[model samples]
Target: MDAILTPAGLLQRSAPATDAPRRRPTREEAEAAVRTLIAWAGDDPTREGLLDTPKRVVKAYGELFRGYDEDPHAVLDRVFEEVSGYDDLVLVRDIPFQSHCEHHMVPFVGKAHVAYYPAEGVVGLSKLARVVDIYARRLQTQETMTAQIVAAIDEALKPRGIAVMIEAEHMCMSMRGVQKAGVSTLTTQFTGVFRDDPTEQVRFMTLVRSK
Candidate 1:
């Protein structure tokens, strides 16, 4: 198990360990698994219309979970220090993303807002969105994903402060269980000055809410 950071900046109980190495399955094996699942659902996977469905699903899964192969640190590696002593909040808002729930493997579509106060240098604006996409492409929970975005920027940029907020609608919640549609979940994480300064947090929220 690995410890997960909470939105309040406290370390809580560890999450299930995901670092264990295992043999990678072949494409044929993956497609076979999909066929087995189809059969379990009482569908004929070999029917003419369904014969290619397994291959299609396996291909889709490869794209859906590609983030697991990406390194977020690499995305933020190039920083430009040519700022003329500009020290203020740099924010990118409403970065749309789609991710799968780690629990049920269903989708949770959302938007992320990221902000940071530069200490000396700053990353490219698009890099912020790239970072969000990298993490969002993985199996995730909203809370863990929020914390990860904040942590990555804080570590890679060493900024004066960092704040991230995510608004999402989870299919696992809406399409199943209680089945409450049109509901959204919001999660936020702040680090450094953003965590200690009340006004900075407010300012970030205000900017995020601005039209």
Candidate 2:
């Protein structure tokens, strides 16, 4: 697992990100791939300051992409049925998340707003936030992540209605591409009552923006 060290830096990926992984690159292989990227980016990975860079980068990537190992449905599995007769919109706002863009591999950081009307029971409020984190920790588009959150909750909780909105700033745009700073992209998804009634959508938005 030792060689002259690759200049890839962090350019190479370990394996295809999917539920079923038949094979994955070894740690040395991953580091070498990073070294390959460093060389591609015009940096000498063997330099004194850069010697440990590949290892650090690989470690950081593991945390950033831990979502791949998580089960979204499991987060909502423990629901609380005792609502005392409560049946209305349950909103969890401003759940901050960081995700990588599938196309560029740069980050898109933002906050997510989620809400749902209870059909049978309710999940722990924090469980909603956990769901957001599960999807956000993966490479994704804001649009797909938004729908995925709604779908996960819908299937696990069987809620009467669901609403999810995400607003993010893609680093690919700010750090590269057009280089327009502070530009935010927003995405949303709705189902059941929220999808059927415009007023409910308004209500969800109002609560999210309030304070």
Candidate 3:
């Protein structure tokens, strides 16, 4: 029998085998690979069970962790000057967030408690959330993520102090990988005044726990 090649097969034959291996996957490549993973995992990728999953997951990721492409200073560029000279404590609590643990690449579900005391001026409420997202998107450990969030706030605002607390359940522990199942971790970072003054630190802790 003579050989016959389909267009895709010909392309595959002519294409350099190592081309893709030499380069990192782009966002689209990652998404497509994820769909491929579904197929490899003993299921039909085209089934209604997964009809929109690939697109939805890709879009959700771009929205959830869009902070990687954002500059922290840019997020903090616009500050609020209408605080009536109220410099005391600025708290934005229960800033809900979700992240992927670097160790297992599984989800970590949690809320962040962020606060800072203005050094020169204060930032918008949403910037705190942006800071949280910035550090959360990357493969991360809870401890590092907590510290990064605090550091970003400290650097951008140069606040008298900054504090971050992350209370989360890591799927690396909860899901199949290790399977602790019901354990949660609390991680925190404090800077400047939040670290210097015991009274101030205690107050911030109290407020975060109150509700």
Candidate 4:
């Protein structure tokens, strides 16, 4: 992909995100909607015990869904070129995250394992985790979130190779229909060398699984 320049004046692989078309609901409207949900759930929203539940849920939603207002590219805009030429695979494993399932709006908690081989430069280790958190804050499927992590890093850093693995337990499956817990869903995404070369992919997984 051709590099695109970002507002940060840095060249990256993807374009900046555009704002959503529709206007966001006001706080009052959001809280009111929560009240409606509470009532639909066979609860009294006006009761003393449940009176402020809507407000609390709305406030929590703001934090949980703040990723829509965040920019993943910005987190990775700054690149560090001075690695003393030590350009091997940089991997960050066990990155814990909690993302809401788009299908049911329930949470899927998981840890992300990320690896990338630098082409231009490396980013701060924390930035990779931050990228995961940003995307995880939004409504997502485990599969889509895994690919998005790879794309965000691949675009911002234009790495020679990139790999992402996510293992999660979705509440939609456990706490609802299936009712069976402890089941995990694993998803992976590979690009460049990691995609073209099978051994590299093996090595990436090996490192992640290793102690």
Error of 2 at 101 (Å): 0.4
Q: How well does each candidate superpose onto the true structure, as a TM-score?
A: 0.92, 0.90, 0.76, 0.90
Write model 1 residue lDDT over 1-211, tens digit each, in one string. Answer: 4666655453435855576766799999999999999999999999999999999999998899898899888999998999998999999999999999989999999899999999969999999999899888998888888878887787678898999999999999899999988899999988889989999999999999999
Across 62-105, the per-residue lDDT of candidate 2 in tens digits comes to: 99999999998888888888999999899999999999998899
lDDT of 3: 0.76
Off by more than 4 A, model 4: 1-20
Model 3: per-residue Cα lDDT over 1-211, one tens digit each: 1233432111112345454554655877867977998999988878997977888888887776665677766787776767778888889988888888766678898889998888778887887888787777766777767766765666566788887788988888777767897687998777778888889889988999996
The most accurate candidate by lDDT is 1
Clashing pairs in 4: none
Query: What is residue 205's positional error in candidate 4, in angstroms?
Result: 0.8
Q: For each candidate, how many residue pairs have backbone atoms clashing (under 3 Å)?
A: 0, 12, 0, 0
lDDT, ranked from best to worst: 1, 4, 2, 3
- Mark the 10 consecutive residues where model 4 has the least summed lDDT: 7-16
Per-residue alpha-carbon lDDT of candidate 4 for residues 54-159, written as tens digits (9 for 90 to 100): 8899899989999988999999999998889977999999999999998899999989999999988899999999999999999887877776787788778989
TM-score of 1: 0.92
